[model samples]
Target: MAAAAADEADDSWMIAQEWMVWWDRPSWYVTIVNTRIDSIHRRKREENEENERVEGERREKKRAGTRGEQGEGESRRTTGDRATWRRQVKRRR
Candidate 1:
């Protein structure tokens, strides 16, 4: 029965009755405080998730931007190498 009740209380890590008995507080106080703490944890989790998602998107955009810049550099390097090779061929001829 305890295990079954525990499973049903999955929404909170803290138990209201446990808090009431442990704190020697009133039932209403235990219920309100436990519910408040659970809500705070939930809000924090949501904020962290949102922050991570935004940071991931920012990093992805930065990486894509760098890839475009590097592509231009690679093409310029190739052109420079080809130009140098052409000059050498002309001199030989």
Candidate 2:
């Protein structure tokens, strides 16, 4: 008798689950597809933004390095002494 009752309870639960799935079946496919597409687009946008940020940082660093090298060359030409160059380097630090 207890086994029979448990079986009946399980059947009822399965019927309820089936009913819920049937009710949502009409729009479930479209909803799932749209959700997946939206997630893909969001990830792609985030990745592109990250790449752009890294590229911008790389460009800035490159420009700063070029300017520093140019300035050092000009200073060395104008000063024409190792001691003066050392002092300038210390001052920059």
Candidate that would win on TM-score: 1
**Local distance difference test scores for all models:** 0.72, 0.75
Model 1 CA lDDT for position 69: 42
For model 2, the superposed segments whose C-alpha errors exceed 4 Å read: 1-25, 69-93
User: What TM-score, over all chains together, does every model reach?
Assistant: 0.50, 0.46
Candidate 1: pairs in clash:
none
Best by lDDT: 2
Sliding window of 10 residues with minimal summed lDDT for model 2: 71-80
